[model samples]
Target: MNFPSKILEKSVEEISQLPGIGKRTALRLALHLLEVPKNQADNLANSISQLVHNIKHCKECNNLSDTEVCIICGNSFRDDKTICVVEDVRDVMAIENTHQYQGKYHVLGGRISPMEGISASDLCIFPLLERIKEKQVVEIIFALSATIEGDTTMFYLYKLMKDLKIKFTTIARGIGVGDELEYTDELTLIRSLQNRVPYSQDLI
Candidate 1:
């Protein structure tokens, strides 16, 4: 398709390269940006550019931050002894949204996927191990996605630390707190973290 302006074509091409954005949508977005005030467009471009240039990973947890340490890792109140291992900064955000976890996090950068040419060394695994040892981490909760790649990565880490006397656990997998049992999906039902009452007398 021919664009009326080469500049518009270039804008569409760049925007279309973003994930989940097709050329048609990119074209529409480019056109929409044209309707906006020049300063607003400039501000959008400037913010993206500034983020690209200034974004830094937290030296401690690999969380995206503008400083050497992310706000979570730098916090004094969070449980420093328990580290939640996740695949990326996005996973960190997802867990944070739950508001239930109070431990620190270790971003693995990505799971080990040979098909994608990603390996353990390519991730932040070594730094994570270093943190565990240096920080005397007492427990590690694997918060990775319930995928083959996620499992493969977790297994590899488990093997490496199995003899270290550190406790290991995974996030509870089950129905959401609000969902009824009848509406619950099968996989969640199968892998449910159900348990009997710890102190049955307390239920009375």
Candidate 2:
């Protein structure tokens, strides 16, 4: 059924391809965009295009940035001796929003999921090891999710970095099982960071 114009239908189809965007939501968004001013839509399109074309991974932490290094890596105010390892840039953003952390971040890009065919090598794990060797890092914090894949990745990292003298810690249990760090509230994230426990100690 061709209820809308060709452009509207095409826009809806494109929007529906985005994660969690169903046909109804896509159609609503397309209609809203059509009702908005031409300049607004053009600006939105231009911004998305620029983001797609210009953004690149940071050489050091593998975080998304427009330049070789991300702003977090380039910032002198952030603690250089501590690194918070997370599954993705969104997790970093979630922690940053809490304003309870002052250390640098390393985005793993993904978790270790054998079922999904993602391995340890698929993530930026080597770079994280290299960063620890190059920097005067004193600690590594695991801010990964509580999912099975996240746990597997954390265990892999712990074993890999066991020879190093740096302290290892994981975010506290406030973020319930099966809960994603990205979905965690600001207060809960902050409390989790503050109440982080040593991974080794918890194991014992």
Candidate 3:
């Protein structure tokens, strides 16, 4: 597509790089931004800059945070003995919205996907193991998405931690076989959390 201005073309190019955004969508967004007020665009630019530069992962659970420890990890009322393991910060937000769980969380950063060349070493698994060793963790609730990669990740984690004497459980299958945790409704997520079952190799 040809643009009258190189600046608009550059904006479209940059915006198109974002996930799920096509070139046409990016062009429309660029035009929309151009039509918006100057300060509104400036605010959008500033927020994006802040998101990239100011955000840091929580040292404890690997969740995105402004501080070393995320609010969930730092909360005194959260259950320290039980930790819900999730794929990313988005899953954390999804579960938090349900308000059905009171345990701490461990974000694996991402799941193991051999097709994507993402291995166990590519994730925050080491920090999670270290956290388990340091904390009085008794139960691990696998809150990963109900996808193949999610199942693979949970099984791998189970194999690694089976010798640690901690109880292993997984969220119920109410979220659907291929559903992502982030996209599940709050009611379904709440029920899944409430009806979690023991994690066994046979279930995979």
Model 2: per-residue Cα lDDT over 34-69, one tens digit each: 799999989999999999999999999999999999
Candidate 2: segments with Cα more than 4 A from true spot: 174-204
Query: Candidate 2: worst 10 consecutive residues by lDDT?
Result: 195-204
Residue 32: error of model 3 in Å?
A: 1.1
For each candidate, what is the lDDT? 0.90, 0.91, 0.92
Residue ranges of candidate 1 with Cα displaced over 4 Å: 180-186, 193-204
Candidate 3 lDDT over residue span 88-138, tens digit each: 989999999999899999999999999999988888998888888899699
Q: Estimate each model's TM-score.
A: 0.89, 0.81, 0.84
Each prediction's RMSD to truth: 2.7, 6.9, 7.1
- Report backbone clashes per prediction: 0, 0, 0
What value of lDDT does candidate 2 attain over all alpha carbons? 0.91
Which of the two, 1 or 3, has more lDDT?
3
Best by TM-score, which number? 1
